[model samples]
Target chain A: MTTATAPAVDSVEKPGARERAKRPGTGVGRPGFAWAAPAAVFFGLFALVPLALVVVLSFTRWNGLGSPEFAGLENWSKLLDDPVMVKSLWLSLLLTVLGVLVQTPISILLGVWAAGHQRNRAVLSAIYFVPLLLSITAVSVLWRAVLDPNFGVPSQAKWLFGDGNLFGVQASALGVLVFVSTWQFTPLHTLLYQGAARAIPQVLYQAAQIDGAGRYRQFFHITLPQLRNTIITSTILMVVGGLTTFDTVLILTQGGPGTDTTNSAYYMYQKAFKSFDFGMASAIALLLVLVASLVSLVMVRLSGYDKMRSTMEGV
Target chain B: MALSLAACGGSAASSDGGSDTIHVLVYGDATNKVEKQLVDTFNKTSKVKAVLDTIPGADYQSKLQTVISGKQAPDLFFNWGGGSIKPYVDAGLLMPLDDFIAKNPDLKSNFLPSVFNTAVVDGKPYGVPMRGTQPVLLFSNKKALQKAGVTAPRTWAELLTTVKTLKAKGVTPIALGGGDKWPTQMWFQYIYDRVAGPELFQKAVDGDKQVWASEDSKKALGMLKELIDAGAFGTNYDSVKFTDGGSPALLATGKAAFELMGSWEYSTLQDAYPDFVKSDLGYGTFPTVEGGKGDPDNLAGNTNNFYSVLKSTEHPEAVAEFLKLMYSDQFVKDQLSIGNLPTTTNTPKFLDGSANPAYSTFQYDLVKKAPAFQLSWDQAFPPAATTTLHQAIQQFFNGQMGTDAFIAAMQNLPAA
Candidate 1:
């Protein structure tokens, strides 16, 4: 081939060298520019841009319509004195604590029982998972019907208990709600605990039995210690889920009978969508996220998930 | 090369030129065959091909707003009269029909005066009213009334008396679907108008007077409380859906004595009871309160739906032609026979009767003799105000706030 033709071939083979050399910042020739582009774009747009916008918008008074003005933290300073926020925050914590305390032991007991029974385990598991199959709205509606003072199991229960029509508030209503929630979510924790329980070497239990450890003793020592990680994980989940509960509370009580049952999430919906106050809503959302994060962090630390593997490996 | 290819894949389909297609969005099931018949009639007669895309009524506002903001809006769509269309108007997303009306004077004159006014906002017409109806009378069952030995409630006192008697007879006096936030406000607003008088009610909704805390307002809330206490709303009141509540079980089963519903409810009841059209169905205004200024004849409600053309349309002329077809004389007659109060000035030839006897009383009260008409409170106010009113009603019902506080909260709300 002639020299000019050879130059043409080189041009074809190695295009954009001059262009690449002149590129700015990370530079075109470097792997950093090519590799970091997607992540950089994502982090900048999603994380940094939104965070900046939220911070700026937090101060401004915009009613989710029209252009927002630079109100200079007027919304933020107003957040300090909002009574709804205080009530909602307390309500959220109360629900979380109540849910966890009520649900955990029932889940644990069911988990332990099911672990020993192999024949009906699948059937039992399916039965336990039935609640998960129903959508939150459907579940709320079902429970509402089941707790109806005039038509529900409570009225039937009243008849059974001889309390009859004399009963004022259906005492069974709150209990039924808690029980249904546990029934719905317990299967998840049960499976986790069951898996963890099975992982405890059968030899350890056998050895403990041989060494004069009674069933209760073996349970307290070997079984409890072995399931610590699973319990901590499940507890964290239940606590967080309960803290952010919305659909059930909204559909069931609508924070009704005078806000007797309004949780923070439902309250936030009432404030935001129902009331259309984006500023107050955002403040509540941020507060909720902060509280959940702090609680989850404390839980992880107390559960020793930081050193969970090391402790497990040592064991 | 791959990135560009993916971008190409993500791109939306662009409409080619000369397409005769016009998209028309509606909400809810075409309640009757009226909308379907109208659309079909337009497509057959007109050059423009119109397609109806129906969304649930509850989600229509939010969905339409998104569609408009994204600039993928339909050619023509449904809107509530003028007030609800303001949000879109302010954004310059609605076509002004003044020029169209000027070009077609006959079409402009076709609509009733009240009907035409609903489409005019800021002295410019945006929507064309299709069918109008008043929500004045509630259909009541006489069997339940006779058993309770109570007369048809003509005043607020008579209504409460009926409630007590119905409870004694083991029937629910009234059925309300509080699960729908809008209906809860309906009960509150209905009482608000009846007790405070219609002028004050309109003034409050228009941001001129704050009536939420007026003695009349307190009386309304107190009346509602009385109903709740007397078992008017029934158990699981919060769980009932609106469409299901006002008609199905309440009017059809006869277990409930009265349903505070709109004129369209007559058809629903007829569907449930074959003889409903001929026998035993009585319609009247919400009863007046003792010593209250609210005239028994004061009205509340609007025609069912309005149609507006999108500002981004390339075919404004075609939209005007389509609206003319909808509001024309022939279309008006068909709609009126089916119990729709047509917006057009077309006279009806009713084989059944020129007057829908059950609805005429309320219509007369609304159109002729009524001193004032109170718009649906939610539809009348801006979104923020609507939300505040909803919350206030809920809070009041839950006993979270007293009547004075509720009024103060509404009175102090920043103007839209």
Candidate 2:
């Protein structure tokens, strides 16, 4: 009876094997083009189509009234001459770099520590994850209230805050922006690293222990190496998120104290909604998209992340 | 995509020609109930129904600009009535209200002339005043002023002295919501009006860029600089915002003695700190600048909100009938009940019915007596110029931009 059933199962599998052999690149259970069609269509309709229109709008003069008139690179030329535009680009880069530098180490340390199997670590990690649940607008408004000069935290801690004029100056305002973003977004990056850390094989650490490696040595040799891909993934997210940061600047600063905190994203909003210069805003938007894409691409290439190799490949 | 969906909805609603409804769009806020009531009143008498639509306040201007020329355009819509509607008027999307006024003269005459004239563009009436006038006033916490041994100032010199006195008492002399930028612009509007008179701004807005560099302009900047140098607003005004209740809270709590804001500040304060508004709030017209060219009673703020008709509206007669309600006695009472000081001729008769009778009477008298009511500079300029204008105002106040740089920025604004 067993031999008869085995032959029946083999006969059923033989046809599937022949089909797989017929199209060698089409592996068993792999989805075809039709599987991705929905997502692709959605992306085209929402993202690609709007991006193409924004490109077209960059070359046209539209005040959001009537139809757009072709202006023949006028908006682009104007942006080139705009000092605010130049300043905004630098500000965007500075804020993004600051965000990465500030958030990465903290996230990594927290993530690695939280990956432990202790009960207290789980509780603390849950508490730390609270910020990630709050909306960006809610986070910004909370920080704005907390940092208000006369009414907020600065008011209570006079010695520390020095009259609580944080938003009055450029440096402190930028600092507050970076600090708030770190406070809100570090949890998300930490979660990424935590998941990655837990996935590392216990055998590697056990082998390191057998070799008389200390905790620090084991972390550096085994854990750090394991988290390499996650670090890249997290940094890329930080880079993109920093580039498009808007709600925080809007609710907290409105790009004020004389355009001190006006990053590219906020500046684009100002041009589009505040100034009603859709043409100029479209130009800025296109530049941001290009810069973000180029940065992400360069980062992937530099990290060899696009190669899709596993961190544990040699092991 | 959402905008397109709205456009489709709007077209679908209006495509049925047999449907006897005229859409009336307004800026959505607590004030919408009044507009809704007014529309109900219009629909009661007319064969054509009046429908009220609102875009939330912040998005109102952008949404209006997008839909004004589309199939979604309303029959009549809310506007600030200066350069706010200039683009639409320039695009010929707005119908000049002269024809409506010609048929019913009260449409032009029932509202205050100054408030009504704000809607006149290129020598033609395009809007009728629908909402109240909001003249900027110097508001104070009386308790704070008493603690500082000072009264609300009546002249520019007295104001300076009051600031010094308030500062000596460890209070922020003036609560400038510099973070909101436009609140900062209120100072410029009053200062420029007093120092150069309304004609200087009028010339500047009418395409004479040279006025921004005129000696009068420099002198106005010098006076503002003197005020700033006096530490009148304290060092941290840029960290405060009235919209967020930061600066207003300062005034309410007696941490600050003064806030120069629009008449709307009364209601804002009432909402946030009713006790402070009831017991301590004191307001007066902006102090006179001695030897300045402008009249002391001249005002600067939003003149009034107006309803402008779309040129493509299918129901003009229905819209005109609806506008007539703007000046009716009930309209004035309803507006006053909401703490809005309507600019209709009959507004004074119902002042006692206002949420704050004394405040209403004061504002009514101020609006009536003012020689010139200068619209806020950001509103006077085309929408395209607001960011540059706001940035310049903020930079100038914060010492980020020098006088010459501010002048250049103003000169570079797209001509109204």
Candidate 3:
């Protein structure tokens, strides 16, 4: 080919060289922009944009009918002194604690039991996972009927509490909410824990038994140490899930017998939908995100996650 | 790409559902069939066709607001009228119906004035009644009351005595759906209207912040507290909701002898407990308190649902035609067929042959002669205020707050 024609061919072959040169160093060796472009665009469109908008919306007063107006500290200031907000925050914290203290132990035991019982595994797993398969509405209705004071199990057990309804009284409402939530969510944690438990070498348990270690000793020294990372992760999931509990509480008590079970997530929902105060709701949402982040950080430190990471790096 | 997509649909332009066809959105449920029938009847001869759309009842309100603020708002929509459309009215998003009324005077004159006035916001009509009136009434499961040696009470004293008698027989005196919160608010609305009178509610809704703390209001609170202390609703009423069928089941099984429910209770019972409905159901108006200023004939409940037009609609005339269909004789009959007690002046003639003739006639007469009817408080006040109002009412009923705290909470309701 002639020289001029070859130059023309080269220009066509290497199009947009100027644009390519504008990017950071060694751009060509990295995957082409088009490779991750779809994911980046989708992520930006859905997750990042919504989160950014929520932050912006937190500073405005929008009634969802009219244009949102800038109201610098109005929503934040109102949230600071709000009694419902304070009560809801406490309630959410209580739920997170309950999830850790109650649901974790149940999940661990179930996971351990499921690991040993190969013969009954199918039936036991099916029974445990029923709540996950049932629609939330169905579960809520079932639980409501089961707890009904006039004709439910409470009536037959009248001699124990003497016609006392579990869900009606304010003092018991929070406990009932926690119990119902744990009942529905324990299977999820069980599945998670079972994965970690099953991964542990069977030889280790056999070795511990030969070394005169009991089943409990084997669990504490071998199984628990091996499952530390999984347990930490499960706790984090439970705590965050606890903070955002909504549907179960809403369908069961509607956050009441007078806000007795009003978690912060449900509180934010009420502020947005019931009151049409989107600004306040967004503020509550951002507050929850911040609190959850701080809590996760503290949890990791307390669980020796940093030391674990350092040990892995040293290896 | 997202920006471009939004930009393409940004203009208030229809993608040719036809310039002659404008959509009407309504909350979906059993009532949708009646709405469709009426729309089909209207579409047959009209120049501008009306298309009906429905969102499930649970998500309707939130979805309506989202679509209104976004790009998909309907030309016309269903609403509970008073405070439901207030924000839209304030934002100039709704078209006032005054011109339509002026052009068609029968639209105003055909329905009961009390029911039609529900859509009046700031002295201007923004909505037209489109369905049946739902007046709250006293309902009894007859055999249970008979077992207790009591009848449906006509006065508050007799009601208290009946509660005592029912409790002695191990029956819950009233079936309350406190979990939903709105049903519990019905008791407050009726008691307040009977004690402080309907005007007090009107004034409170009109932005009189001090109205909730008035002497009559305090007195009403006291009487409500006395009823709660007397165990009229039973200890577990807060967890039982009609929406979930818990409270209604209580009434059906004779665990609850009395229930103050909307007139829809007639249809609900007819559907769920047909045999019991035939053998043991009875109804009455709310009982009056002694020395109360309000007339004994006054009632409290939802008047009817309404259709309001969007200001951005291209087919105002089409919306006008659709609204006019709401008052037609055909509309009245359709409402009656569903066991609804319509508020149109012509509704009375069709009642004798409705789904439940006796129940229909009872409600029709109850609403017709009532000197006043209090629209449900949650519907009467601003929609944004409803959460606090519901919270306050629930707290008071659960005995979480004293009378003063309840008064304070009511006074702080968001301005209309």
Highest lDDT scorer: 2
TM-score of each: 0.81, 0.95, 0.92
| Per-residue C-alpha lDDT of model 3 across residues A177-260, encoded as one tens digit per residue | 788888888998998888888878787878888999997899888878777888888998999888888888877887887778
- Residue A166 lDDT (model 1): 17
Over 4 Å off, model 2: A1-31, B1-18
- Residue B87 lDDT, candidate 1, scale 0-100: 64
- Rank by DockQ (best first): 2, 3, 1
Report lDDT (Cα) of residue B341, candidate 1: 66
Best-matching candidate per DockQ: 2
lDDT of 1 by residue, A255-288 (tens): 6533545567876676666555656666667667
Which residues of candidate 1, in runs, are more than 4 Å off?
Answer: A1-69, A145-180, A254-262, A267-280, A309-315, B1-21, B32-37, B45-48, B105-109, B131-136, B209-236, B239-254, B267-282, B333-343, B350-371
Candidate 1 C-alpha lDDT tens digits along B1-416: 12222333232212224577777777765443667777888888778777667677656665554454343467888777746777667667788887887888766686656556666767788878766555646668776677678778887778877888888887878755554556667676677777777667656655765456666777777888887777776554454444543334555567677777666667666666757545666666778877777766666666446888887777777788788876666666676666666645554333234237446434533654555555677776656566556657766664566867777767865453
The lDDT ranking, best first, is 2, 3, 1
Q: List residue ranges in candidate 3 displaced over 4 A.
A: A1-40, A160-164, A306-315, B1-18
Error of 3 at B123 (Å): 0.6
Every candidate's DockQ is 0.15, 0.65, 0.45
Q: Pairing residues by index, what is the TM-score of model 1?
A: 0.81
The superposed Cα distance between candidate 3 and the true structure at residue B312, in angstroms, equals 1.6
Better of 1 and 3 by TM-score: 3
Candidate 1 lDDT score at position B135 = 61
Please give the RMSD to the true structure for each candidate, in Å: 8.4, 4.0, 5.7
